[model samples]
Target: MSGNIAKHVFVMAGTGSIGLIAIFMVDLLNFFYISALKNPSYTAAVAFAGSLGFILSAISIGSSIGISATVSRLIGAKKRGKARRYAATFLAVMLCIATLLAALNFIFSRQLVSLIGGKGEALEGAVLFLRILAPAFPLLCLVMAISGLLRSLGEANAAMRVTLSGAVCAAVLDPIFIFGLDLGLTGAALGTIFSRILICANGWYQLSKHDILAFPRLKEIKPALKAIAPIALPAIATNLATPVGNLFVTRTMSHFGNDAISALSVIERSVPICFAFIFALTGSIGPIIAQNFGARIFERVKETYRWALRFTLGCVALIWLIFFLNQNLLIKLFHIQGIGIPIIHFFCDYLVEGYAFLGLLFVSNTAFNNLGFAFYSTFFNWGRATLGTIPFVLIGFYWGPEGILTGMTAGMALFGTLAYFKAKNVIHNLHLRFPEALA
Candidate 1:
């Protein structure tokens, strides 16, 4: 907290990126292994399953954001005891919610898969994959909550290791299960389950070592719920917007053919790998902003936001260049064929730059989520997902899959710009409210 704001943003984001990229890399490799089976049905099935999994993961992420933001603020105020109680209570709450969601998703796996247009082998494979992996939802939530607590305590490396361990576990197990065991799609699901278990173990160990967890009393539960819900509910709604947007894209792509769906899957997995740093920024910057805001250091909070924006732009530029140069390589790497080829080509060439704006949106989201305007995050995200998305996508639908992608990019640019301005306004309002902080 006493160091250079730019350095802090860079260091935290860099270390945080390592773990996030590792996990995403593993996920991309999982898709690669599945694609190696030479079955579009398998690829498409995994795509649908992945979309469904993203929704569940969103819930965990949203809940973790609330836990992290609230606890970090308390810690900044020197209320360590309250922070620990909040941590433990939020963890328990998320566990129960995760369990309930997992059960429902597992029971209705087929219907969920079919709702997004899964068919034949794709339908069967997706259903089996979802059912096999559903039980791990609670594990995922626990790991996320624990990681959040570690980050709130400034244990960035420890938090990174929580995910890094899981990535390594998935990396080693995926090939063996998918190829060596000849389990195909089922193997991938098993790999994911085992990986979550490893992550949960690592996170708990790290958090325990910090003494940041304790079992909450019954009375503590009510207050904890009140503290976390304000942020979490909106944060969950915000996070859910992306998947809801993707759901539209996936459902629409299904109409084009398995080739389009497979291409979409490749693109989806490729994004986090390419922009992992940008994705990491949300988690990495949250604690920094929250702590400063909590301490009433208004200028540092604003400075952090600016530095984060700069870092995001630089990251996006570098990633875009790499993707543009390797467009063909990506297509070949994924063994994309037919309509999938052009779709990948177009995304690498035309749509890559849109992520700059998306990065802006993410920076703004960090501000909104941590600076007590969580509802703004939800509003903008849903606006981007629905108004920013649906109409543009429908217009682009006339041109084909590439057109649909183009429309999505437009929506990103629109909401991202708006959110950036809104976040700046939010920070300015903080100064007005606490003029003494400025003095």
Candidate 2:
């Protein structure tokens, strides 16, 4: 809170990106190994299952946002005891919610997959994967909550190790389970489940070592809910919007056949790896902004916002250049064939630039969530997912599969630009309301 704001953003985001890359690398490898089998059905199955997993994970991610924002704010205001209690209570609540959702998904796995256009071998494989993976949702929630707490406490390195442990575990076990054991797709699911367990255990240890979490009393639960619900509910809604859009896109692409879905799957896996730093920026910057806001340091809050946006633009440019140069390599590595080849090529050549707008939207979202306007985050994200996405994607259908990708990019550019301005306006309004803080 007292250091150079740019340094703080870079250090925090860089460390956070390493952890995110580790986690996402595991997913990329999962898809890569599955693709090596040369089965389009297998690739499409993971794609469909991954989309559903995104929705379930959104619940926990949103809850963690609440925990992180509320606790970071309290800590900045010098209320450590209350912050710890809120952290514990939020974790418990999130775990319960995640477990319930996981159970429901497991019970109706086939129907859920079918709804998203999975069919035949792909549908069966997706259902199998979902059922194997669902029970671990509670563990995933625990890991996310703990990581958010560590970040709120400004222990960015420790927070990073929590995810790194899981990634290492997955790296070692994925191959043994998938190949040595000849378990195939089921092995991939089992590997993921084990990784979640490792992450949960590592995260809990990190919090305990720091004495940052306390057991929540029954009386604390209701008050905690009252404090956190304002942020968590909207954050949950905001996070859900992406998967909702992805689901629509996936269902739409299914019309072009499994090859189209497979191409989309490769693109999906590649994204988190390439733009990991930008993804980290969303979680990393929140605590920085929330802490300053809590301390009534409006100027610092504004400074952090500006620096984060600049960092995002630079990161996008670097990643886009690399992706463009290696488009063919990616196609070859993913073993993309048939119509999938053209789709991958088109994305690398054109759609990769869309991520810049998506990055802007991410920064704006963190600003909204931390600045006491989480609903704005929800509004813009839903607008992007629905209005920004659906109609554009429909229009793109006129030009076929590549057209769909174009439409998604157009939606992102529109909403991302609007969200950036809205976030700027929000910061301006904050300054007006707290003029004394500026001095």
Q: Give the TM-score of candidate 1.
A: 0.92
Q: Would you give me the overall lDDT of model 2? A: 0.87
Instruction: Tell me each candidate's TM-score.
Output: 0.92, 0.92
Clash count of each predicted structure:
0, 0
lDDT of 1 by residue, 1-439 (tens): 5689888888777877887887676678778988988788898999999999889888988898889879987888998898889778877877887899999999999999989988899999989988998898898788778777787788888877778888889889999999999999989989988888888887877777878877876778888989988878887888899999998888878888888999999989998888888888877788899889878888899899999999999998898899899989988787787899999989988898899999999899889988878778888899999999989988998999999899999999999999999999999899676666421
lDDT of every predicted structure (CA atoms): 0.87, 0.87
Local error of candidate 1 at residue 161 (angstroms):
1.5
